[model samples]
Target chain A: MSTSSTPPAPPPSNRISGTAISKEIRAELAVECSSIKSTVTPGLAVILVGSRPDSLAYVRMKKKACAEVGIDSFGYDYPETVTQQELIDKVNELNADPKVHGILVQLPLPNHIVENLVTSAVHPDKDVDGLHPLNCAKLVTAQTHGGSVKMNWKDLKSIPFHIACTPQGCIELLDRSGVEIEGKRAVVIGRSNLVGMPVSLLLNHRNATITIVHSRTIDAQSVVRTADIVIAAVGRAKMVKSDWLKEGAVVIDVGINSVDAPDTKKGYRLVGDVDFDECEGKCEKITPVPGGVGPMTIAMLLRNTVNSAKRVCGI
Target chain B: MSTSSTPPAPPPSNRISGTAISKEIRAELAVECSSIKSTVTPGLAVILVGSRPDSLAYVRMKKKACAEVGIDSFGYDYPETVTQQELIDKVNELNADPKVHGILVQLPLPNHIVENLVTSAVHPDKDVDGLHPLNCAKLVTAQTHGGSVKMNWKDLKSIPFHIACTPQGCIELLDRSGVEIEGKRAVVIGRSNLVGMPVSLLLNHRNATITIVHSRTIDAQSVVRTADIVIAAVGRAKMVKSDWLKEGAVVIDVGINSVDAPDTKKGYRLVGDVDFDECEGKCEKITPVPGGVGPMTIAMLLRNTVNSAKRVCGI
Candidate 1:
């Protein structure tokens, strides 16, 4: 008769918050940065074009993160009308600068300026975003060429170059949270070069059975349901439902979608590809929309800058 | 009941042969070569550092294949004592030669010479093997940048670069044979940069659900059995058996393993990764050893040389 008196235990929280994990990484990076030579701080050069509000915000956040880690941040703000050659010239100059260890050009450059041309201009050694063809090629070939059969975030130190930040962040979160990826089924939605494609490759490198479901993928839900790990990057808001997930599936929501929220003071709110409310209890672990992968991106960029600097110093 | 003797219909032969397909492609190339401006023919430079019988035989075959397609062949034979710098100098020399439209450094170079350094020295524009880091990066990002979402061999022209010959050859054989790859389940065994890794990425570009089973993959057979198509590139001999395939799976065996055959004149016979005897009648389609994948590789290399020459001449 007294059994009803026992209060229902609060639903155990399995939220894998990227904010906390990123803080841990940033703290570790700060210690590493300090332990390195005090004479020269790791330098990160960023070139931002066409003052898009979001891109500016992202660039600002990255610079601030660099400062927090005791790294030198150099900024080059250019007008939207900057010629491709001029941008390439700036990149080449940065490439030759002894002070700069890593270089990143804020993405979504002016339509006239080809993204690939601008991104590849960054020296492969200093390409913190890992977009340069040589770096990309190295990432592709590294697994088969003297690298580990399975990739883990801890193993990133052994890799000679930068990895795409967002994907690296996604993996870092999963890895830090103690989720086992080896021998697991991983489904990556979307196949964009920046996120889906590279993450899939990284997962494959980690010995996961990977399935990439894109725009043309048939039965996307059924395919996703088979995964132990699900990475949604289709830029769709709350598209993944409870049914799409298997019991105890770990979810890494990479898509950041803005949706109308009448009740909010701002009139809008950011949501992820997975419906967080439905998935919170169902999933073994899930990342939140605003506080999850969003913060880790900048943290990874800082780590890449430090690593790039370490390489130059032959540490 | 009267018993009438009837011959069992030999299991419908669904074997996809590479020799016949290569001959067809070479014939087409020969015709194209004759129709093009004949003043300056396409030329291929091959640098062989050692006289390993297999390497020499491979170089000779490549040279002979080039001749059949009206391409000029330039050979550079060096002793095993050659230094890495000497090999690199030779590559650089050929790279600057206007007559050399494509350059291939025969693989398994002298122990002292690094394969990647030599392979990368072949100017990317003329890297016929597509082993250069830039070319490998281009292959990785090609789809995300300008190429189609789902890649097929026919779309190779739009990529504006040469793909790894062996992997491209596998896809070409499958495509030309009228096998549909769209939305199919594909399992690629092995993750070698030259074959398994690139082919898996190619199949993913073609909208197939790709599962790559490498040395670290657990329960490899069960993982492979779910595929509608399986590509076996692990160098092991006869590792893929009938049980490893789905009932109607299309198999592309890229592995070429030499096994001792006491009765054979050479005392050894070439076999693919699949146990063809058990698979010949069990699967819907399968490529055979010796005549499968082997010839197609040389044919694709010839195609690449011609394409490179065309690019230089802006044909």
Candidate 2:
């Protein structure tokens, strides 16, 4: 057989793209933003304590996301030497600002500053990150009481408050991708507060049979192989191998890890916990790295900000 | 002739008695309570908004428990028609009173009043029931961050805050009975905020491979049969038969359902979710209803009250 006779394989394109879905969500939020009856615009205040490259980039991206949705974005950048009290004062100021409906303090704060003290200073109503203790408590309460687990942005009246952005983003991506979450066997790999734990609760709220697989979980591979939906957020690069997944399972990769790539200009490339190439032809749906959960996070942030503003306006 | 030869089965006395275990815990708490350096006594203030017989009985038991430990107990009884503000005001009054170190609001408040509002009004440190939003958030945070999962009342510094009484009691009962929880295959039935959800989280925190089986779970019996430790909190009478349990599995029955008993004074007798009669000689350990988790809740409440008083007095 001649080498040229073999047809070139088609591009690997059967997957959920967070960038495209996030754009759709942003467009929807923009419409809601313009329709607000209140004279005050939906505003987000971003506080960046240190000038770390990744942190600055994230803040800039969040501000741009705010602008795209017709929101008024405010930025505050503090030096690495900023004291804890100074940061908390800024948060209190933002809390009192009527125009600023949401306040977000970027993570990985400097060593001298206590992150919890600063995060808790933001008023729950103005907390867009949804990392506030009160917000976390509300989620626990809602989940325990069998409250609204469905993500219906149109029906904000039922939800207690802003949900954690990353988990909310994961759900938005899954729902918008047309995945049926209810009554499905869903497995979440990892149990971090940031992604794994809250996402499992959200899935359970939507009536899915949830099993959380963490580091100490025995027979993790076998447990994951039974899931109709698999969420990987363990933060290890390509940890969830192809063989670990069930056939035709809907996969949502929430990990963003950097691996060595000598050919790239930065000498590093991003990859999800799942080996994307390995999952190419097996899963019914999967999310790609860099453009998957990353984009959806900011979109949810904007949506939460708009929701906060709407609540303030009583609209 | 066969029944006579069997010698009547030696009376199933191997099971853990919550009443006996709770008595031990109360004894330990009493010793700690009497050694307090503060001049004021540890006090618990319970607010009962209605005349529900169950609620009244629960409150009366709590006061009696407090008195047994040389602690002060206060009660606030209000009509069901009391407004939300009135209840909240009473909570605030108790919160400010130095004499009252813990405040508990009876559950199933009048339908007219929002329960969350009244629950949140109780100060977090003084929330003896551990149902306040702050305390619930702390539990979620601890579980997510790998905090202390073991119940070590003697070493209070390790615990971030008080755990939910029933869940804490479950762990205490197991620990006191010498059932090792670490690295075990644990199955939790039900997903309520009170018992099931928190118990699963607690078990997970202690390095157990946790599987939460709820109403939406499929093949629940098969799933449960794999557990080395089974916690049944589904509130269904005799739902977990012997067939559903693995041989030698340790069982913690949190359910307190009243099934028909025509010969009894109340026309009913309490039973756990587990069919205890069927598991007489099979399981390694089990908890019986009416003398199991029921007594431990009040013991935990007393412990929490003393801890709160210690915190208030900076002991």
Candidate 3:
């Protein structure tokens, strides 16, 4: 009677493994890529300005991913001194290239290069990054029209218009994990166009009541605690605490921040906006930083490229 | 208590009079319209597909407003038997005509006619109603870029792109009333493309945190109660009760619903989403139905027409 059986053997961790899911998606994309290659070879043109180490690493990873999925990757590297007009000209050249199904411009361009002008220069059909104004507008229109339309995400081959990679990845993670988005309260902790805003729109399209809390938000913690699904993309390292989340909330961490670490080989460690260690057991399903949204982003990008190829080839 | 003092006079009702503000705006627009007319006549083409009484009444009101602002109004009347192709053909003709600076297709076309196809047929530059996909996309792009750019709504001559009229009207009301939008909690009920979604984006661009609650929202009342600014656009009469609001919240009621009113010869009266009588003293400022939002919408449309004329005429 006195034996207290190890506190009922605490329930298993509910961590959502984006790495495994992304692997599966990449395998599927590989098959789709090969099939599409028969009619038209899928190609992605990645434009990188200035050799920021991090940006270079991201580009390499993307190129590697494209190769893995059997898609063609073309790299266009520019010097730091390149003019904005030069960049726009390159984008226009890529836009006219029928072989280039998807064009991606690496972000954080040099100060002199106006980002929006360069990004907008890409043709909407080939703008796989989905930052083009037309694509964003289409996303907004989808939200209103999607209210009555029942979309089967499982059967989804390609959205006619491209969506931003990270946000699309976040949704893919949620959907593949068997999470029900309809009627859920989803709190997005940033409002960046690339991630936060688009992701919130995607969630709303799926029928999730959304609350967008930003830097100016008052009592952000309380607002977050009310969410059934929490998407943290504010770029703050470990800013979210266990107490800030409701018990069993689904957490998707999109932030990747580098923090100093004396013991690490790289002299720093990468952490997400969420405090993973503290939030582990509290969450019903949570994505780990490096292995979570990072891999999925690349996967979605590959998918977009393949989709664009199919559309261009009339598959 | 000394002298049995009467409870301090209830603070004066802070009604944000959209009617008065709209009149003021219309006057300003009239001046602008005349100035633009010096170079080229500003014309708005109102397309009426069917003979629905309400649609006819709205069309007439718009035409009257255009006249009041000294802009030319052209009517295109078609019976209910009009085909979608004919409407598109007419819109294309108006799009090509320099005289038609703005083209508006009155909504609620016959069931057979696709609404989006007809509305999208108008060129973006002449889409005074601002329902064009390109215009909606521009509005979204503005939100992302507007973060660092300080826009003076007071001195705003014309937005480079057209925004949905009702949403722009809501913002105009708030700015004119001097209700602080930045750093406020805004709750938008409904997520309609015409009013709710765009207005929420407008508020977010102004630095307010936004929460969108739709019909599927759980505990919608509590979510709304947290708002400092409540925009009720759900189109349900008297749905937002006084108790569902934060004390001293600013309310913009966008719903115009008809309710039974036996005393009136019309047999019905127009009401907004917010319960006016119960919410009057509770709100710090609130817009009234019939006189609020409604007039401002018409005013915004005329302003858009004049703006389009100025752009087209290169004035």
Candidate 4:
């Protein structure tokens, strides 16, 4: 027994540094982009079916991010009167064009065009947003292609890009904040196939013990109270109250809701799904609304577009 | 004051009769099968890789069930030393075989073959057990496809029967016993996709409020204690103690566990996942292991096979 003996176990530390982790991952992605062929500009297509100002603002930020990452973007500003068949035809046209690698129809469509038709029409391989039924299937099951009946171990890398952007952002946020996903207890408060389901699958793949709570889950709040990591994405404004949060738990709030706020000059204030006022002292780390999961969603959209282009071109 | 007659709210009755419900379903299936062409035989290719005495006995029972139900059964008995490649080859051969409408490889294959591999190879349309990745995807996203294409809705009749055997059996047991599934609080223990996942999906579709719990879930035992209906599918011996069960909660034990019972002549005895001794006075309805989900599994399997043949021939 010498001075080189192992040190004693240190006291636990409380910190949530998700911002740094996300920044580092972004930096790594930026480096990877630069290392690849610099002149290959990734192309993204955004089809808007209406004049929803909110959708426009979201699309504008995404286009700006594309510029930042050397990706070219195109947008189709269609009137609200567009028919479902017309929108589907446009998506089909984009799907056939070799120049267009990704197709995204800004959601909240004019209610005429069935969203399912638009989602299904996009080629699965080119589905960057991962909303296609086929893509969703692929994300859950590691099965191989329509070309091969057998699942090749290597085929996993070819999984379609653009899973639920908010969930993808949540994963990045957790990793950046130094939260351990492996074998940790994670509870997601929602069951939408979009974010809750995909995020749960991703977390399950990473070996984190996961539980999904829906409206039917009786006393689901009590379940959330025990989670090491709690993801509030129920779309309900501050439904996950402060009491439900486990002490020092890393929180990833994926909901961007705007409640009535006449006090602000803008007439409305942005708030995440979590009650920020109650969570400040209890949570280890939390993302602020407007700058948190929102930005990450746009960033991931660009990333998925680039990824889809790379796979198609065999880059 | 008008002396108008008021309708009485139905009293909470212990009406979920599990045994009677199962019998009712079997009888109903018999009527449905008889009304159709009796000559319609759903052909099943049963691939047995090993010679486990218990497994062999199960196979014989399945063959007997098929015969009882007017199903055409073909048994492929492979040696314990069968290679994974050989198994895969056999499955492909059967998949292409026109006569074989459904395929089932007896589970717990010898050490050489990966169970997930052989099981997944069974064509989704012909997959009676609903274990194929395609079916799994369909279940998750509510899409229908027998294979790697847009499967026609007509193909559904020919597709492997949607045999919610055990879960369906639970419904049968309840119906026979006069239990109501609609508008009841249901708690499912275990989250295995094969049982818990599908059952929860079925229950959700039926409008019964459901809460699904698994190993990752916190206080699973406590959650079960409050349920009106509890489904124990976790393959743990005596895991769900009677104390955790709600008063008069209908319990469907899906576990088949073998525990030491030197007291019995066979040197060991069969036991369900639940402690029936403790459940004697507590549970309103309970299914024993040997006669419970076991028989229903074979019954549903045969039903699936017959339906498969019907769809294949467009009957």
Candidate 5:
């Protein structure tokens, strides 16, 4: 089978291309953009406090994706030597900016500064990443109890974007690969709000009886195997093997781990948490790393930013 | 071994109890109380809307428990005809009064008034039952992100008292029963915050691997069977049979279920979610219904109320 016309992995562990879905979304957004000439392009302010190569790369990818989707990117690059108050001030500036619809400080902030305080500084409406405490309160408890948004974005309270994006990407992959999610058993290996918990909510909303297995969980492998869908986000490489999977279970590997893949020229290759080689024949569907959920996450962020602006602007 | 030792079951499933452990907890709390003055009692205000029989029974039980614990009980029985605004006003009045340390409204309000409005009205410090949204925010995602005073407290934010009571009971049961919670395969058979969710958090805090399986979960029996410690909160009659349990698993059944007992006077017997008949000689330790978690829950409510008063009064 030629690489160009190989029918894109439908034979075994079929991974649906995120590019296709993202393209459709971009087209819709473009139509929306075209309809309104005086369009308010949603502005995202990303605060990078440290010089971690990975975090910078991730931020860069996000900015590039934002540009592709018609969202404006505002970068706030600060040195590690900066004090907590200064960082908080920068967040406050972004929070007050009428045009700024989103603010995200990359993880692993300086130890001296309180990350939560700074993150909370961004108004909930501009919390496109939805990492704010208010957003989390809504997610874990009930959406109805969401802390008051400073703006008129009534809809932002309901759309838990940051966590929802990753979960949505996982679902999109499965759906596009022809995997059945409704009324099927699904096990999410991890319970952090960013990935596991929200995925469980989405899966539950979609009618999949979901089990959330965390580091504090027992018989996690057995739980994962029973699921028609298995989403492993536990960062550990190859933690989920074929033997632990039920045959034909749709696997959505959310962990973008870079293990010692010295065989490749980049010194290390991108590998998912799942043992992809072993999983291909065992599962009916699986999302690949680098090209799978990675692309989808950034695309979703842009979509969220646009929506956030629209809701707050009442446009 | 004898029927006299095993008291009658109640509700949807047998709520597993530690007759031995409850005795131990009482003894310990008694010891703790011996040092503390009885005059400085925690005040619990029970406010009920309407005359639902179940709600009435719950309030009565709470009042009775408060009496036993040397706590003052202020009962306010309101009518079903109360408007949402009037209820809010009443709750605000309770919120402002220093005399009222803890306020509990019997749940399933007349469907006309917003449940969230009434619940969120209680102040967090005075929310001894711990169901307030702000308090729940404190539990799930602590403010300032990584600060980690991160207490899951007595309950899920919904019926804060509901979870706070169950969590306190579970913690007490485990301690008295001598079950090591750390690194245990703890399977919580329900996803509710009142018992299961908070229990999961408590177990996680204590360093246990946690798996939450519910009705939509593929094989709940298999999941439950693998736990080092099993907590059954699903209100199903004998849903967790002996075979579903591992040989030496510590069982905590939180369900108070009533099933058809043709020989009993009420035409049914009360039981825990676990089958007591099957649990005997199996688990190293287990709690019995009627006297187990049920009493412990009441005890904890009294304790939390006292604790809430200490915080609210700055004593």
Candidate 6:
């Protein structure tokens, strides 16, 4: 048989390393934190109720990060049976405390506590989690001025309000990775308030033509395939397939799901909403699970705290 | 001449009559107002910051509507040179007045006045305009539960918070006219705080897949053509053409612009962002400008006032 010339293999996808970028951001924040120490130390008060193992691990990671960045961390642990009024009272105390620049109440609180009421009780100034209704409203309102204002993400202190950490991290991933956001067709798969909705608003603020597809969207694949940038935050394991993405599209996968992996030590592995192995080659740029948006989220929380401290100290 | 077979003409497009719908809602509100009067009469404080002709006309129209619906209208007119503090103090006074159930500050306040400070001064319970940060936050938070909370537009009293009137009117236009929103592709053109952004959120809350395209959006026409529903809120006159719309798409034109019309006695005529003559037959349904979203805005304001009264009177 005569040998035929084979086509050249496609170039490897550009994998965005959220860990490396997060390290860079933390280094910069460390410098800022040191500089601000002359005036006032940035302090973050983290309140965790009903210590689930995962949440406890997350809080430990956050506190460790705070230490590395030279920020003071205050941990307040509550039992599962703690009353809602007690949590609100603690939040009010933190709001009045001059030392506390940011307050974060861990999510998935005990069922007995009303999440919205507890979250709303945080004063807007110290709402580093950016889950407060006032901060959320600011996020919604900030981008509606017909592209008149451009956000310089590097100047965190300039922003008048805090943005949700995960969503902000998603943007930071794109911004730091040199992905062009303005005027691109961006599809966000999911509509959860914590990530999907706020991220869509942030992308819109950056001048992306945003389409938000959710559980009710018919032919979600077809809708996603039209995007130049795809953000998968649906929290389903490998729910997004290769065919759902447009070739050469930039993807930021915000979902972290545990899937059965019998061969792994814990009998499971963490996967994102996107099928990374299948999608990596097809995407022009893609964020990997665990090393992707997760790291940036903590980095943003530190940045928000530092900025809040600066604002409070009139730096 | 030889006989030739020709295709029959297409069915006529449905022209949604917002004026008629507004009249129907006003009548319903009148009934609600009379019933609420048994406990407490609904009172709206309309604050007009200046004597701009359009602002004056709008204030007059709102007062007339309030009177027709059996609600007391308290008109507060300010000179152009009024201080921001004065306006805010006035707002504070109205906020504390038990007789006032709703406070509406007419938009485009004098340039000297700080609009946000004055608007935020109105207590959230009395912010019928829904511009206050708290109310705006409620609108964003209310929709984030991943389609779990379905908004029944008819049950105004159950919403717990105010939604901006024009955006609310856009949804009412769709709901009243029997346009199915769920699982449909909806494109909203514009990103103004008052209209485009809020309307997109409202549509998202209704489970419609939403795309928001604005000035910075590239290939906006192509993006819009994929939508089953189009909301034209950009202030430009006659910018959306028939070719930009999907076949059988329902369009809600929320724009009211004054364009030069030499033949008219006033040498000007009100038109919408969509080209009415070109798009009317092409659309499955379309709302006319002056008689469409404009009238519905006033109607929703009245509804918000009545709802606030109901909540306050605990009826």
Fnat by candidate, in order: 0.51, 0.45, 0.59, 0.12, 0.43, 0.68
Q: Give stretches of model 3 more than 4 Å off.
A: A1-11, A35-37, A81-93, A96-98, A143-158, B1-11, B35-37, B143-158, B312-315
Per-residue error for A225 in candidate 5, Å, reads: 3.8
Tens digits of per-residue lDDT for model 1 on B1-315? 857688778866799989999999999999878877565689999888878999999999999999888999999999999998898898899889999999998888766666777787788889999888777876777633432344444577556777889999988888988998888888899989899989988887777878788887778998899888899999999999998888988999998999999999999999999999998777888999989999999999999998998888888
Write down the C-alpha DockQ for each prediction.
Answer: 0.48, 0.43, 0.49, 0.14, 0.34, 0.50
Q: Model 1: which residue pairs collide?
A: B150-B205, B151-B205
Give interface RMSD, per candidate: 3.6, 4.5, 4.2, 6.3, 4.3, 5.1
Clash totals, every prediction: 2, 0, 0, 14, 37, 0
TM-score of each: 0.94, 0.92, 0.90, 0.75, 0.81, 0.94
Cα deviation at B247, candidate 3, in Å, is 2.4
What overall lDDT goes with each candidate model?
Answer: 0.87, 0.84, 0.88, 0.70, 0.71, 0.89
RMSD of candidates 1 onward, in order: 2.9, 4.1, 3.8, 8.7, 6.2, 4.4
B181-268 per-residue lDDT for model 6 (tens digits): 9899999999988899999998988889999999999999999999999999999999999999888999999988999999999999
lDDT of 4 by residue, B108-145 (tens): 88866677778877887688876775566655555443
For A1-315, candidate 2 gives per-residue lDDT tens digits of 677877899886669999999999899988988888356689999999878999989998999888888999999989899998899889988899998999999998987776777888899889888887778876655732233243443333246587888888888888888888877888899988788878887887777778788888878888899898999999999999889988899999999999999999999999999999998678989999989998998998998998899888877
Candidate with maximal lDDT? 6
Please identify which of the two predictions, 1 or 4, would achieve the higher TM-score against the true structure: 1
Cα lDDT for residue B131, model 2? 81
| Pairs in clash, predicted candidate 3 | none
Please state the CAPRI-style docking class of candidate 6. medium
Please provide, for model 5 over A32-82, each residue's C-alpha lDDT reduced to its tens digit, 9 standing for 90 to 100: 655653768778889997798989998998888777767788998999898
Judged by DockQ relative to the true structure, which candidate is superior, 3 or 4? 3
Docking class of 4: incorrect
Worst 10 residues of 1 chain B by lDDT: B143-152
Indicate which candidate wins on DockQ: 6
